[model samples]
Target: MISANKLAGASSSDKYRQIHDAFEKTGRHWLYNATVGAGLPVNHTVRDLIDSGDTILALSGIFSGTLSWLFLQFDGTVPFTDLVDQAWQQGLTEPDPRVDLSGKDVMRKLVILAREAGYDIEPDQGARGVAGAGALRRRVRRSLL
Candidate 1:
């Protein structure tokens, strides 16, 4: 399934799930690499690394161009929500701005990465609570340092 849309994850409501499911199940090999790129096709790289017996600790990158630009424009001078509103007004966000605000795209890509990394992580299971999120933020920040 050559899909650029954010519908490849395990969403039963998603019509294209069958195509992506096939690619995930039987190594159909025709899957289109979309999202979660780190200068290259990161999903394919993760799959390749897994196939070659490499362990994937974490997959990280700026998946959404709009989100990346929004972060760049944020310097705390204006409320972050105000920046999001501005971006939405400028048509830089999805038709439903909540999708971007909720990290919908990024969460879906995270699930895909988890599956490729050989973890049976479902979309719902990918959601970490506030406390877990704080620890994850700390870990990522320390890694950068």
Candidate 2:
């Protein structure tokens, strides 16, 4: 999977090697758009630019879930907490918004982007307790950092 986090301590060459090894198991036919990127078509375009030897000084955009949540917000008159809960229910947030809210999502996204830009980044430990929410908002708040 094109994870939103990089395997820490791995160099650029090492990242590519790891990526190749991980994909080799699924068979050669299973080609992931590694050249592309995380959110969607934009990643692909960025990858194309990189492949063409264009120097990518900086790149930024909203993550997929953030976009999803923004779209969801306009569809109803739900309260902020309820809208956030709905976003979670709809799987728009990263496993848990508590994690997203606590800055883990940003950390992971940054790490992934930095890795893509040829930097050696460390992994984050932000999603450590995003569990046992028991199908309720209480669980989400409890899991926040």
Candidate 3:
């Protein structure tokens, strides 16, 4: 019969457990980007960028499509409505996409990123949503056109 500790050790080898361990060890976070076809590696992590004093751009959007889809939208090949529909179909958006569109999700992400960068930002302190009725879409369309 396997001992409890042995079983625990065996189970800890699971991929998610390993990832959790890495995160604990390094105090870093990882995000999987389907457009890149892989998780951001350790060297390219947010912590590394912040530590190195490099500028980091984080885009927080409700569209569940891959990062490549986002780029296409930027180029005006994809419509904002279509992106929202796709994200809903993919179960990535709340039943009310407004919650995301209102920039709450983006604010949360920004707060986390700021905290990791050594900023003591309260969740309610620094988040301002730029979301408005068709504003983002109109801006993108205008810029690309």
Candidate 4:
């Protein structure tokens, strides 16, 4: 598990609980390779680089590709609903698509990033000013279905 944020008020346990709750509620298992980037240990990297600052400039990244596997299963003409069903069966999404579809995953990542970037970002604060991510949302939705 990685350090989810670096705010003054949010405890380490609180962030871990939030990640745990997200996984529990969505029934999706996550295994992140904290070594892929960030030269230091996961928690320390976040604290030294991202949390020691303010004004998060940008956020971007890729997500899981379970839907890609699901799509490749089809010979042709796969029904959207069937794909949706399969994605669910694979634990690829939450009970609702809204969370994954609405960029909440990235939002969570961004909250973590913003905190890394040294801002005191909470989930609600990240959620407060979201630009419409229409294209990205559509792609995630299509993948889910």
What are the TM-scores, per candidate, against the unseen true structure?
A: 0.65, 0.51, 0.40, 0.42
lDDT of each residue in 1-145, candidate 3, tens digit only: 2121111221222543575477778977544322111233322355677888876555343322233344455444667778877876787555667655665544544554454444545556754644483797697668877
TM-score: which is higher, 2 or 3? Answer: 2
In terms of lDDT, the best-performing candidate is: 1
Q: Write the per-residue lDDT of candidate 1 for residues 1-145, one digit (tens) a residue.
A: 4555555654432434566566779876655466555336877888899999999887666766668879899875787789988998998777787777677867777777777788876577666544477887798679658
- State residue 90's C-alpha deviation in candidate 4, in Å: 1.3
Question: lDDT of each structure?
Answer: 0.70, 0.54, 0.49, 0.52
Residue 107 displacement (Å), model 2: 2.2
Model 3 alpha-carbon miss at residue 38, Å: 9.3
RMSD of candidates 1 onward, in order: 7.0, 8.8, 11.1, 10.0
Candidate 1, residue 52: the lDDT equals 99
Evaluated against the true structure, the overall lDDT of model 2 is 0.54
| TM-score of candidate 1 on Cα atoms, chains taken together | 0.65
- Candidate 3, after superposition: displacement of residue 31 in Å? 10
What tens-digit string does per-residue lDDT give for candidate 2 at 27-108? Answer: 6532333322343565456557777887778766654455446555754355567777777888766676776666555555
Give the winner by TM-score. Answer: 1
